[model samples]
Target: MLTLLAQTGSAGADSQSLAFFNFITTHWQFCLLHFLEFAIWGAWIVVLGNLLNARGFTRKEIGSIYACMPIGTMISILILGPLADKYFSTQVMIGVLHLVGAVLLILMARTDNARRFYWLTLLYALAFSPTLGLVNAIVFKHDADIFGGLANQGFPWIRVFGTIGWIAAGLSHTLILKKGQPVNANPLLLAAGLSLVLGLYAFTLPADPSKVALAAADAVAGEPAVAAVADVGILQGSIEMLSRHPIFFLVTFVGAMAMGLYFAFGALFLEKTGVPPRTVGPVMTIGQWIEIFFMLALPWFLGKDNVNMNWVLLVGICAWAVRFGVFAIGKPLPMVLFGVAIHGICFDFFFAAGMVNANLIAPESLTATAQSVYGFLVYGLGMYLGSELSGWLNQYFTKPTTAADGTPDTVTNWRAFWAIPGVCVAICAGLFFMSTLGRPPAGDGSNAPAEIPAQASEVGE
Candidate 1:
């Protein structure tokens, strides 16, 4: 009997091992999909502002450059989201758009003229923004078939590769460029190469024609705009949620606008603060590295009932003030690093937690739409407005000057520049905190809005 039992146990173990091996072999493409998707983005975005600064573009021009992606995201939400859902294969659209974007990226790298680069970047943004949603759609549509009962586990593992890919992209700049090498177009070229590879690889993935994830903004898609616009009902429901949670609405809009200040100028800020060009890419990635840890720990912070939502979100919004305040101070490199590192908290705590709260607050029928609405407000309109204001402010603070080496140059009162957003966010935080004081905690039955059914109280929990 002992011998028979031993043999049976060995057989079961062997079967399990074989299944695990098959899982890895079949799902490797999805992992690569996410890795290359983010790698291509991280390769250039972290350093683009600094490069533009070096190229003699004004801070305002750079802000406009940054705005292109947000504009593209808004268009994709309204147009590409529906197109990918109804007419085209998700994989095919991703493959084609990325392939086109790769070409545009090459053009962008070649341009020395700011005007030309602006147009090229706008075109590239349109080509690239929709792919963010399409990639998520592919995973959501196929995870069930690929991982079966383990689909939940499979998604995060595959998604984590995106974070790794972003890290790799940043580290590559550190490795390839020597210290003090001037910022150049090389990052753009590297991104183009990766996009080419990703475009080709996307073709091999399974064909999917399903709808794009309305909650695309809920994920770390890129530079803050993770949403695509959806049904009118979703937009209406999102507006209602904002109306009901007046505090949430105000904090989210203002916080995202403040986030724009960083996205538009953080790289340039690092450069001005004495960070070497080669190391800046890796340094900017500090937040993303920290984000991985915070994201994993978020469930703990959120608690089982997510009763901590208000505090979590409030802290997240508050981090923006902290980061901007640190940047405004701009001394003691460690202090600056701390500000950079907390980007994870800013994103995971505020944005990610906010998405969860949105789902909880919305009725089941409006859940997906609610996600879309929140995304549109935060990343779409809010980010765009912020970008525009940041540009105008940077331009206002800048004055033309001659470099110490007797070359023509410009200087910005960066301290003053950063302080504006810092003060604005601080005010927003104070207002948000005050608003939450008398309100019921998130997930409580009393917290549910009149439009939400009673059972939503359980859902919130």
Candidate 2:
């Protein structure tokens, strides 16, 4: 009887293993698409500011340059996203934009002047921002077709490959360029090469039908072609929710600023604090590597039985404070790395979970509008403000000085610089914690399991 039960279990395991193997074999193209998509970003963004500093640009200049990406993203949502929804096939648009972006990246690598670099980076951002959304759209379009009811589960498996691609890019950048070499444009050049490859490869991807065709079909059936321009009601409702939920608004806004500060300076901070220049990319990637595990475990934390989103978000916000606090202390490398290792918690708990909370706070009819409001507030307005503020702080903490050998240079009070954001995030987390002490978890105040957005789980730098 025992042997019979053991054989049954063994057979089940074997069947599951075979099923997974088949799944991978069938979906390899989508996996590769997700991989190259992020590889293009991870290659250069981590170390771009550091490279600019090595070339003598000021912190303010670096901050301004970093701000462009968010600006471009905001613009794309207004223009490119709508246009893609109405006109172009997803894959064709992706291929053309990336191909154009590759040329812009190459130009950005060759240009040394900060202003010229700024303009080129903005242009590259405009060309690249649409692809992020487009990639997800195409993947979902196909995922629904392939997996039907299980598309959500299937997505994470393929998307994990993008994180791996990011990790690979970081390690590869370190490997290709040594610490002793001039911190030249090698990172951008590497990104350009990858972008070129992905551009050509995109053209060959499975063609998802254009959204325009669907809209046209609906029109022919005497349905509304568009919703007719008034999100006014939805917009008004979203604003009212934000006003009513000040804790939610404040916490999300502060957390986003913390994210902005990290993206702007985290790589440069590591390099400044005795991490080798070449190894900065890899060290920065430690967070992303940790991100994979935390993101996977997120559903468990946010399970229906848990019902403690306030606690989860507080912990995430506090993790950022800890991350910056350690960077300010800037001591034993292991502790610093520990701080970096917790980024998954910081991102997944705060930002990813916050998306669900946003969905819950708004009425069901206004779900999409609520998300758009949250994205605009956090990724758009919040990130832009935070980037600019971080740059200003960098400038404030930096001063011109002379080295021991008499070379003129600038030195930043790194401890002071890191402390500001750390303290700010800490204060926000504390306030949020205190506010939530007696309240129900963020949601509609019911026991329904929050429908977590698949896109929210996606890892980003």
Candidate 3:
């Protein structure tokens, strides 16, 4: 009888352990949500440029396809964010958007015409982008309920699965589609299928507290907002909040611009280094595989009592410069791969850290709005700018030349192209570091997030 009781106790402890590992929520729906959300994006985003290139599209034309996503993201965040924050259920919005986006993805697969492809993708992105913020809000709300701290303790671990999703997508492309060799292949269809699965799965997520309810809570006076934006309106309040905190806005711009170049031309850089068509996806996955480690490390790195998240961003952008420099050197597959692997540091530090920081600073009510405002500034407008800039850089560097076979070739001066962005980003990193040099991260605002709530909904009320 004693032994049986001990075993039962052990089983109970194991169940508790599992729940803690899952951030102690009723379920781990958000982790699955992140996985599917990113997997759909990963299915084609990493290789779509190369696919378009295979079809005889110019770099500029390929950029147009890439550019549409930011345009779509910007529109979704600006419009949908306010609507969701003010009126609708976050999970419901996510489900509906993914379903709509799935149809668009299917349509994208059926097209070979560039204009048709561009419009279809644009519509899909518009449908898909707002979910990024809504998912974050859901995760934050769950974290607040469970962990009750300024920083969401299990968020990094949860988000790391999203990276796993991207890795899985790349693995599928490499193992199944063989690095997206054909201009029209299985990528879009694969992504569409994944989107459909996630759409249906979204309805099963934890329910959200309405912004209207939260707004009412704020109006009760003395009790601060757990989920309402300030009286200035969701969009206006979010913008005002971001503007007040210059650090967030600055890093968002830098990170978004750097990402644009990576999204637009990263594969092309690998191709220049003689990576084979079949190997491209795997090679890229190496970076994300490395990122998984960094993502896991982030909680420790930035989770200290007062470790400034800005310091994390500083490391990321510096790594970005180093990566471009290494890519510029461009020889020996191992060397190129080594540099690519540093993406672990580059991406996790800036973008991932930025998301965490955004959470730290915004009130519970405005979490979605904060994420949306940041999304619009970075993913939408910032990515669009980067796409244009990178495209122009591509055009400027390509020149007519004679190859060893005396065939006319358009030569890409990869060294110069890579170095320019590297220098500029390095400077941006330095500037960011200087700005946050002595600022420690906020700590232990158990009743509220560590950020100043003067900019929040209940402040005046």
Q: Which candidate is the best by lDDT?
A: 2
Q: What is candidate 1's CA lDDT for residue 50?
A: 85
lDDT of 1: 0.75
Descending-lDDT candidate ranking: 2, 1, 3
Segments in model 3 whose C-alpha atoms lie over 4 Å from true places:
1-30, 85-87, 138-151, 154-157, 179-183, 204-248, 308-310, 355-373, 400-409, 433-461
lDDT of 1 by residue, 1-461 (tens): 99999999999999877966676677888878988988898899888888888888877788898888878877877777666656777788889999999999999988989899999999998999788767765775664476553444445556667888888999899776667777888899899999999999889998762344423322322211223243445556666766777777677878877877788888878888889999898998888889888776776787756777778888988898899889889998899989999988888888777777776776666666666666676667777888888889999998989999998888888889888889988888889888878775556354422121111111000
* lDDT score of residue 71 within candidate 3: 88
Q: Model 3: per-residue lDDT, tens digit, 1-461?
A: 99999999999999868866756254467668878888888788877877777666677777777888788766654566557656777788888999998899888777778888888878887888777666666665444453453333455546666777887887786565654354355777889899899989989987775665444322321111223333347657676677767765776687678778888888777866777665666678888887777766665677554255667767877888888888788867787788878877877676766666765677766665665566556667888988878877887888878889987667788889888888888788777777776666644354432222211110000
TM for every model, in the order presented, reads 0.86, 0.91, 0.77
Tell me the whole-model lDDT of each prediction, alpha carbons only. Answer: 0.75, 0.78, 0.69
lDDT of 2 at 206: 84
Candidate 1 similarity to native, TM-score: 0.86
Off by over 4 Å in 2: 1-18, 210-234, 443-451, 457-459
Lowest lDDT sum, 10 consecutive residues, model 2, at 220-229
- Going through the candidates in the order shown, the clash numbers are 3, 0, 4
